[model samples]
Target chain A: MEKKQRKQSPQRPAFLKVLQKSGLSFLAMAPLLLGVIGLVGLFQVLVTPKMLTSLFQGNSLLDTLIGTMSGAIAAGNPIVSYLIGGELLEQGISLYAVSAFILSWVTLGFIQLPAEVEVFGGRFTLYRNILSFVFTMLIAVLTTLSLQGLS
Target chain B: MKKQDKPFAFRGKYLLLTVLILYGVIFLVSSQSVQLALLKSGTILVKILPIFGVVILFTSLLNFFIRPKQIAKHLGQDSGTKGWLWALAAGVISHGPMYAWYSLLEDLRSHGMKDELIVVFFASRAIKIPLLPMMIGYFGLTFTILLSFYILLGALLQGLCMQLLQTKKM
Candidate 1:
């Protein structure tokens, strides 16, 4: 019985080892997380909805392009994007523009690119971002058209 | 048991320092805005705390019970349609800031998860379950449902593109 109990001791240590590894991983992630939060805060204060809204000119193609660009640059919380999207719609910005903005806001992250590249490497990050950018435009158009059809 | 790389660790610290310095400079220009920014940042930190804890615990549990072989089998290069489904489901359910999941995804990648699945996961995050109500409130129910559907479709489309490109490379 004593030998059996002694053999089981290794299992407890294994779990402990996992916990330690996890703790270390979280510690290592601290700096990157803080930096991302700080950058997001700066963006929130620096870029206003009015600034983003003013850039839209009501042309479907141009506004979509601008909207995608703006969202990519000002990437942050989805909640914040919704607020800005609401404001833009109230200001008469077309759904095409607003949809593009909201979609890119969540998907593309020029600001977080460095952190992503750090974790996922350069090539993968580049491909993912570019694909996301293209899809944002495509989906935005489809979503708007679908909504129109549904209504 | 691999010694984690340390060379790039300093990069994270440098990024934080640079951003802090920027905050300091901006503080001098407008203290109120800086204060507001700090408050907002604090609020964000608070909101993510619980989620972060859960993530760390989940990651540890994953690392403990699931081996690299299992990860490869489920999310690996040959995981096929099942892998795509798994990535989409995980992305839809995941909450908190996307950056929080980066480390876990990186770990999974090292364990043989495909880049295509990773792209799928990232793209699928566009549909936030908790925030769906708010989205509907802002943009009618039909628009919300349609947008959600398109986002899922887009995610899979992006994943397909990534896989094609990766295969072409190999």
Candidate 2:
């Protein structure tokens, strides 16, 4: 078996070299990727945590409705949601608020607008994203209401 | 220089011009609050940098390891109900944002998967493997199951819609 495997390994290095080269490309892309991250971070800082707190302190349903809209505009990975979720929860935000925030964190979010628009076309992407946000909030509201009933 | 060696018109100079134009437009359109939010979230982005690197590396590795032909052989249209089931099953097991799956989906698309299956892959992302148990705790087992089923159903319907559009294009 060892001898047979050795016979078949002749072309392995040629292919492996490409994979090895991609590693350097990944490293080179790191700073550009990090710069994009910093840009997002700047957006978050500009928004101010105080504004975020006030947004969720309103009537639970309205908070969640608008939260969904806002979330669609600010999409990224779920870690952002968890951090923002924890903050909202700490500020006496309701379960509905947290739920909507979490859902929109993933389902909605405008961070992908440029890329999405590029792929799916500007009008289509905008409409679909808006529709997704609306549906998400609707689901959040229904889920919260249903949970309340169950309790 | 060989014909293939020549770059496309969209590359190099054209790309730079496009980027510069877009940046100027963005700067003009953005509000004060938007600018402040970017600054505030800058640290958060820095912290998540390592995780993004790992995720991208892992995704690329998975692409390297998982042969598209084999994936399609098991999950192609002729696989019938089982194919759809596996697409949803596989999607649930996958991680990262929906956008992360774009390349994989494009690969699968080339490998004979239908638009419906792609839709399922995108929509089924609502199910978080680690968080499902916690969701059950908060919303009850029945509710969780129902919602999951509903999402799958939505994906199926959306998939059919995409198929219809494709047929129209054809």
Candidate 3:
């Protein structure tokens, strides 16, 4: 097996040698990302600030869950998340909900799940998203409490 | 069933095909959706295309100039807090959609990045260091600092959890 590996290792031209594994993975990423982009485009249409306002009622836990659910469903630039996070805060939403929205908007990626699966594999994607989602809510709660303590 | 296939092929072309089909159905049901989807995707692509190009170019360069062994030496299991800091800084400084970084992260993983660092990278994205001033404007400096710290804390814990769960096997 070692001899066979050695025999197969050196057939590349010098120019192509540098574009081996990383290049191959980069090549694979394109198609996988196409679906992720497609899903994100569809989801973007479904999420709006009006839709978000409907989900929050100032209750910390419930707001956090709704914020997470909405965040997971939406995809955008982090700047957009901050803008939306500010909007959520001004519109009578609790700090917990706003924090959850911003956190998960940046961290979680239901739309990118397939791409993650393609690149990192299904199990890792599932575990990572679940943990991120849970921690997003936790961070949201903690952020609210810390704010309270500070004030 | 001829030994049963793995369904996803690791690259997830199957998932892309499924999404394509779903989009097709949407287009057929309402041609307006085609316009909407196209517009959204076009804008996203326009904004990200440059970054995508740079990232892919860097990946090829990295593959050529650096050996996977060197990558492992810096970012692999025993690289310790330095690896974590590298990941945190990378995640914090990065600006753009998550998908834009997926290819780069995959390339890194192929070259021996630890799963924990990947988790840390994703988690630390919540920090948004450049947006700190704006965040403070909305929520006050104290709230912003605490929130950012909590996010960093969460990233560390999530990375640790992902590591403990053995996500690398996937």
How accurate locally, in lDDT, is each candidate? 0.86, 0.57, 0.80
Evaluated at residue B56, the lDDT of candidate 1 is 76
lDDT of 1 by residue, B65-159 (tens): 88778899999977878999999999999998788898789778888999999999999999999999999999889999899999999999999
**Which one wins by TM-score: 2 or 3?**
3
Docking quality (DockQ) for each candidate? 0.61, 0.21, 0.50
The lDDT, on a scale of 0 to 1, for candidate 2 is 0.57
Residue A113 accuracy (lDDT) in model 3: 77
**Residue B128's C-alpha lDDT in candidate 1?**
96
Q: Which stretches of candidate 3 lie over 4 Å from their true place?
A: A1-24, B1-10, B167-170
Q: Docking category for candidate 3? A: medium
RMSD (Cα, Å) for all candidates, in order, is 2.9, 6.5, 5.5
Give a tens-digit lDDT track for model 2, residues A1-151. Answer: 9999988675234435535433453443343343334445544544544565566646887888767765655545555565676677667777676666666766654554544443345644554455456556666666667667876
- Tens-digit lDDT track for model 3 on B1-170? 22232232246678779888988888888788777877897788788888887777777776666677788877897778899989988888887778788877876886689998999999998877777888888778888888889988889899899888994555
Task: Give the top-scoring candidate (TM-score).
Answer: 1
**lDDT tens string, model 2, B62-160?**
446545566666666566777778778876877665544443454455556665676566656767888777666654686676556656665565556
